[model samples]
Each structure stands twice: as C-alpha cells, then as structure tokens.
Target: MAANESADGSLRAPEDFRSSTCGDTKSLKKSHLACRGAVAIAAISLITAIILSSILFAIWGAAREEDPTFQNKQTENLQQCQKQCEDLKMMLHLATQDSRCRLCPEGWLWWRRHCYFFSVGLQENRRWKESAEFCQEHNSSLVEIKDDAEMDFLQGVMCNATKFPFLWVGLTDSQQEGRWLWLSGKDIQDHLPLVVQWDSDDRDCADLRGDGTLFAADCEEYGPWACKRES
Candidate 1:
C-alpha cells in the first residue's frame, strides 16, 4: 500500500508540471498578440499623418492661388511696363521727326512737312505769271493756301519774313470764269477755305492780302511772292 501511494503521488506531480507549462505557453501567446496590435497601431498612425500633411499642403497651395493682392500686384507691374514701352516709342518717333525737319534748305523755313520761301528783299517785284515761273525755276511752285493750319502758317511766316503788302500765290480763275483753281489742278473752292474777295471783271490772278485773305487781281500786277516745296 505504501508503494502504490508513492507512485500515485509521482503521477500527480507530472500533471501539475503539465498545467504550469500550458500556462506559460498561454502567456507567451498573449504577449505576441499585444505586440502585433501595437505594430498595427503605429502603422495606422503613420498613414494618417501622411494623409493629413498632404491635405494641409493642398489647402495652402489653393489659398495662395486665390490671393487677390498678389494677382493685382502682378497685373500692375505688367501695365507699368507697357506704359513705359509706349513712352519710349513716342520719344523715338518725335526724335526722328525733328531730325527729318532739320533737313530743310538754308534760306527756307520748315512748317508742317513743307519748306517755304518768302520773297522778302528781292530787287524787283514780279508779276503773277513771272512769280510762278520764278518759283518753277527754283524747283518749287507758288504757294497754294490749303487748310486753316497752312493758312495760319503762311500768315505767320509772311508777317515775320517781309513787310510786303500783297504776295502772289498759285490761285487763279484764268482757266474758267468764276471757277478758281490751284496750280496743282485742284479746285480752290474744293480744297481751300473760301476767303477770297472777287472782282467784277479783268481779274484772273490771286493775291494774299496782309489780312490773310485772297484778292482777285490782274495777272500783270507786280508784287512779292512765296514759294513752297516738299522738305
């Protein structure tokens, strides 16, 4: 009976050792599961952080694009540059025009793209036809009053150059009665301001009075004259 009892006690001791081994295995498994869970949480946190960062960056870029002050500043800079370029071009054009105007003849005067010569101190006065011939000899023609601007220039130049009473121009009604014509074949009534004083008869040539008006006169009348040509 004592031997049998000892064997039973040894068998019970083996069962207790198996139970302890099982408990250790269970604890190791639980620790492994907890470690796996922590790793998964870290991975999820990293992914979420990356997503949030990307979202913030996109919002910042959008805000910058919508900034009105920044856009307006860029536009203002562009407009200022354009205006400066236009001013430079205008300056160049004016310089070129001035240079061209300086190429007029020494004894002539430059006005509005034409060179004018007023017969100021001629030894002898010329008749209307003789004045026309004289101007033609000089590679020009008798002055033809065109627009108000040219008339103004002629008056100003004549007043400054000479004290002559009347100057013969290229206006005449000799071609047809009562129909005035310029030397260029253009009708005077069509091209120029009709500030002419007509006579009843025996008047075919035109003369510019000191008052800046035209007067019909005889072709044989002698007076100082003006000539005009391209500059």
Candidate 2:
C-alpha cells in the first residue's frame, strides 16, 4: 500500500510542473505580440506625419506660383493697350498731313527740313532710269525714307490713297534683285515702304500706287512715282 501511494504522488507532481511551464510560455507569447503591435503603430504614425508635411509644402508652393502682382494679367493687357494707342496716334498724324498736303500740290512736302512727294500723277511712266531723269528735271530724285516716323507717316498716307494707280518711288533693286538700294546710295534697311504685291526678281524699279505706299513693278510699266529732295 505504501509503494503505490508514493508512485501516485510522484506522477501528480510531474503533471503540476508541466502545467506551470505551459502557463509561462503563453504569457511570454502575449507580451511579444503586444510589443510588435506597438512597433507597427509607431511606424504608421511616422509615415502619416511625413505625408502630411509633404502635402503642406506642396500647397504653399502652389500658392506662391499663383501670386497676382508677380504674374499679373492686367500688366500684360496694359502694355498691349499702350502700344496700340501709340500706333493710333501715329496714324492720326499721317491722315491729317495727307489732307493738308493735298492743298499745296507742289513737287514735294516740305516738313521738318525734308521734301516728300508721291509721283503717281506724273505725265508718263518710264523705266527706273527714265524716272530718275524726270525727277532730275524737277531738281529732285526719288524719295528716301529717313526715319521711323517718316516711314510710318508714308505708310499711313499710302494706306489712305486710292489703290489701283501706281506711283514711282525712290527705292529700287536696279543694282540687284532682293538687294534694295535707295536713291541715297545706301542699302535699303528693313524699315522702308513695303507694298502688298511685290514685284518679281526681274522688276527692279519701285513704284507707288495711288494708295501712297511703294511697290516694285516692271520698269516699262506706266505708273506714278514719288520724288524727294533735301529741304
């Protein structure tokens, strides 16, 4: 009887030890899971903070780009308006001069120490060489444009004149086509009178239609012209 009791007691003690070991292992596992959850939460919070900061920075940059004073639409519009006003003023001056100059009906316009004339009403249309002679007969040669105001004035005058009749002008490519030479013997700059219908390469002489601007035409064509002399 005593030996049986001892064996039973020893088996009970071993079972109790195993239960305690199992309980300790479960507690350790629960602590490890809690630590992992805390680490994950910290990582998520850091990422969210970074994302929010980036969004704020982007919004600030966009606002700066849209600033009104630095990128003002009104300023651009005002500049365009000013330029148009200047052009209109110049046109008005030319129109007034055109009307006043007609009363004189002289060889050239004497203004600001210069002479200007549109030769479209001359008696005959001749080659460029012949037109030069005709101008010489009047103690003047073909007209020369000296400055921007003069060119603008001439453009405005020609635009106002009748379109079909041709006038002789001072500019010609007599020396070389595409290389315009004025009566002043200087290369014609880009600022000279430009007609809508330019002459072909073979047509070196410049003539003005009744419209007042100069155009290139065949030297033999009968047309009016412009002549100028120093005032």
lDDT of 2 by residue, 1-69 (tens): 001223333222233322322234345446545555555554555455556556555555566467756
**Per-residue C-alpha lDDT of model 1 across residues 1-231, encoded as one tens digit per residue:** 001223333222233322322224345446545555555554555555556556555555566477857556655554554555555555545544442224344456778777776765532566788779867765679998778888888877767755767788998888787888999998887765575587546899888977788888888866778889765
Output the number of the TM-score-best candidate: 1
TM-scores, all models, native as reference: 0.54, 0.44
lDDT top scorer: 1
Off by over 4 Å in 1: 1-102
Give all candidates' CA lDDT scores.
Answer: 0.66, 0.55
Clashing residue pairs, backbone N/CA/C < 3 A, model 1: none
